[model samples]
Target chain A: DVKVTQSSRYLVKRTGEKVFLECVQDMDHENMFWYRQDPGLGLRLIYFSYDVKMKEKGDIPEGYSVSREKKERFSLILESASTNQTSMYLCASSLTGSIEQFFGPGTRLTVL
Target chain B: SQQGEEDPQALSIQEGENATMNCSYKTSINNLQWYRQNSGRGLVHLILIRSNEREKHSGRLRVTLDTSKKSSSLLITASRAADTASYFCATDRGGYQKVTFGTGTKLQVIP
Candidate 1:
């Protein structure tokens, strides 16, 4: 069984604050992704990393960035949080050639 | 941009009944996968059907894909109370190493 863990299940921050969400996967997957799920928008990809120090912008990457300093850890950073950035953040990882992804418990962020 | 869109934003069915959901995509895909997400939780992989295959089954879940129409359907047989959750369809567009997910259909099973 693969385990994906997030640093926080729930987080709250004020506007213009810097926020960091961390994700760790035990499966040693090569691909990692970050997404924000909204009510009607579904899951919008924020960023994805295929390897350490490598990141690609997803459909909705504005105001967000990512870091993959280590193979097992990925982090999502909000330069300056805004109310519009508040949403459920989900982290997922998959192998290089495998399309099946394992997701970590989401972090529901509230930007006041 | 979301690659897939699921039909019927919400569905309600009685326990022991069957529930079906549909998903439509815009482009060619290497594979389509279904995921179940409990409220406020991460998604769990349900099944994956490759483009070369038309139908696939796992336990009580049956997934069908139509490449010509770029559509897919998921059928849950003998639905149970624990089956109440949101179902999402994801599409992998080959080498991107990531998939795009649909809005999801929220299913509620009445006991």
Candidate 2:
């Protein structure tokens, strides 16, 4: 069984403030992804990392950025948090490509 | 962008009854997978069927894929209360790292 540990299960940040959401996976997966899910809109990808320090933008990456400083850890950063950035953020990792992705519990963020 | 199009966005079934979900997609794929997600939680992998395969089963869950039609279906036999969740179909594109997901079908199993 793979365990994806997210630093926070719930978060609240004020507008214009910088926010960081951290995720770590015990399994050494080559690919990691960040997604924000909204009600009725489904899951929209933010950013993904294929290897250390390597990244790519996904479907919705306008207000977010990511950092993969190490193999087991991936972080999502909101340069300037806005009310629109509030949503359920999910982290997932996989061996590569579209193979089964092991997902984190999720972090519910509320931007004031 | 590639997407897995799912039909019957929502369903309600009685306990002990069977439930079925369908998925359709465009473009070629290497494999198709099913997933389950509870309210406010991350998704759990249910089953995976490759393009070459027509049908596969795991426990009470059955999945079928029709490449000629570019579609697939999932059947949950004798569903229980715990089986109630949002079901999604994901397609593994021929590319190494492009996997797209469907909008999902919300299944409610009434007791």
Q: How do all models score by TM-score?
A: 0.99, 0.95
**lDDT, candidate 1, B17-111, per-residue tens:** 99999999999999999999999999999999999999999999999999999999999999999999999999988875789999999999999
Give the C-alpha interface root-mean-square deviation per candidate. Answer: 0.8, 2.2
Regions more than 4 Å wrong, model 1: none
For model 2, the superposed segments whose C-alpha errors exceed 4 Å read: none
Best-performing candidate as measured by DockQ: 1
TM-score of 2: 0.95
- Please name the candidate that would achieve the greatest lDDT relative to the true structure: 1
Could you give the interface RMSD of candidate 1 in angstroms? 0.8
User: Per-residue alpha-carbon lDDT of model 2 for B23-80, expressed as tens digits?
Assistant: 9999889999999999889988999999899999999999999999999999999999
Would candidate 2 be rated incorrect, acceptable, medium or high by CAPRI criteria? medium
- DockQ of each two-chain model: 0.86, 0.56
| lDDT digits (tens) for residues A1-112 of candidate 2 | 8988888999999999999999999988988989887766667788888899999998889988899999999999999999999999999898864588888999999999
